[model samples]
Target: MLFQNVIKHCRHYTAPVSAICKPSDVFTNLSNEFPYYLPKIIKTSLTKKKYEDNIEIKERIKNLSEYHTLAREPIQGKLTFLAFDALAESKDLTEEKLHQVQVLAWAVELVQSYFIIGDDMEDNSETRCGKPTWHLLPDVGLLAINDASMLRSFIYEMLKNNFDQNTSTKVENYVNEAFLTINIGQYMDIMMSKSKDFNKFTVEQYNFLNDHKSSFYTVKLPILLALELCNKVSQDSYENVNKICTDLGILLQMQNDVMDYIDRDSAPVKTSSDIQKKKCSWPAVTALQHFNEEQRREFMNCYGRWESEKVERVRELYKEINLPHLYRLEEQRINKTVLEKIKKLPDNATPSADFFYKIFDFIHQYTEDISPSILKSNVSMSAI
Candidate 1:
């Protein structure tokens, strides 16, 4: 599992580096401070034999760790551990900053778990990270919402417990701001799904949708949270980090869309969740805007419908439109632009270049292996 691997890697580091050795340890330590720790409640309740015998509740909690391990297990815990270790290595990280980063990492993990739980329910998904999704197992369903909410509450608890001091107001403020941004992005994504005409979507709209819905949570929030934890509280700091992180987030999401269409080995059952949901993904909206009228009509006919043959027809249109080539070009361009932007950051303001570099490296490593076929064609957003 990624979390386990992360724990192992962090432990391998000597002395101070070992502080972040275990995420569960981090969560447990931080949660001890919260006035109300829901995981403690869930944990206590689940340990009761009767509760475990309930079968349904057991499955949901059981799946929680599984969903988390998906992101952690593959990279051998390198992502979170590396992020945390960067702070450990920093000569400037105050005790408060160090604690904030730990709590922040915990908060982000909680948020991610919340999303995965709710997303599984929303998509009616059956499995995640090789096991049944929370909603799919007996006795789970709507309770998954509560489980997700528990994850959200954990964020507040961590904040209140660890950052209640006056000096930490900036960290508090940034956390709230990032939360608002994510909510706004999620709202836009839901609204786009209900939109009437797929053809009406512009490339700009597609970019906006992807930037908000996918980018903020994955890229923007994590890095911004890091900045906040580092006590880099100036508006300039937030703005610079936000812009860079948002761009990286958008690129990561675009790559995700591309991967869904192309990667056959992906754990998600179907690749066309975005198409089925009528998401205004970059490729879909781009195709709609750029393809000739005849091709456009063909695309509309096949767009979100579930038939296998029609999905194949959509793939054909991508090839005809040279979408794979376009996607490759756009990806390379965006990556280069992001790298240049990162380089331009004032040396003092940015963390070690290796920190940012590792992040981009992880994104590239994950998405680069995906075949162009999955990327150039439309796929389901729900799958993620």
Candidate 2:
């Protein structure tokens, strides 16, 4: 119901259907061109390794495309195109300009693929989108590390191929900033998980983790790229749109932290690893604050442990404190708050406010139309 109520009073979404790129179109373009940088990457693998006789490595290079060709919602690409398309309405974007947007959008997905592959390994995650993660595939254990790096290398290659020298340099700054922030955030996350010290698992720390680790790169980067292309980087609207991106990033990650604890059928759960892994997630932080002394002892005892009985104790404590219901209330408040913030962005200005509103519209459709019973993994990926 909070999901339904959210964005209800936000501006009525009025972006023209003809003016925007569809998710299906983004997906088609991404899948069609995903292999663009593979040959070059494989050539490097073959030449650099000097492993022509190594059948296992040779086979990996031959089949590298399949690792990246996985079908996805491509929310980042879609958002990038929407932001670019929104700006286009003011001054018509040429076909070449639109093509450049597509190239960057493609690169965003490559970044995402790298994150998923590497994060899964780091978290010891077993499945993704209902399939075993890349590292779990035959003969891919530690080599998947190189595979993930290979995926990341394509992003720079795409940028170099598509943008002018000055523009390429500018975009590289954005890429470097995003990569560094996410890496630091991830390091903090893994450190906290390993320690399992409730003193360090404060809400303030969780907010830091959420903003840097998942939100900035997921929400902020694509929007920044679009603004960069529009030459709106110098305008005040840049910071205005950025604040909104930050808010939505907070909201998006809160959804992930809460959803991690929600019970579900065996299939389709991307992971409940957050609990067993002792992630300093939202629910854990919230519950820690409200817990009594005995409760705190019990929680710290059960949390972050792998055994089923300990995991069950965490579940029981969550139910006793009504964490799921508390999350619903908090979500409703944040959802309304973020949508109202988006509404305040000037529609007639440099970066159209309509873009952010329409981005929420896409999220609205995904939440309402797709997988109502349980929000799909895409919900965790992003929409804002």
Measured by lDDT, the strongest candidate is 2
In candidate 2, which residue ranges exceed 4 Å CA deviation?
1-69, 90-93, 346-349, 364-372, 375-379, 382-384
Worst 10 residues of 1 by lDDT: 1-10
Q: Residues 182-232, candidate 2, lDDT per residue (tens digit)?
A: 888889888888884589988788878878887777777888888788877
Against the hidden reference, what TM-scores do the models get? 0.72, 0.80
Clashes of each: 12, 0
Residue 280's lDDT in candidate 2: 85
List candidate 1 segments past 4 Å from native: 1-66, 69-84, 87-102, 162-173, 263-266, 269-271, 351-358, 372-384
Give the C-alpha lDDT of model 1. Answer: 0.56
- Alpha-carbon local distance difference test for all models: 0.56, 0.67
Put down candidate 1 lDDT per residue, 63-134, tens digits, no spaces.
Answer: 553355333322212343345455453464455654555556555555556666766666665655446776
Worst 10 residues of 2 by lDDT: 364-373
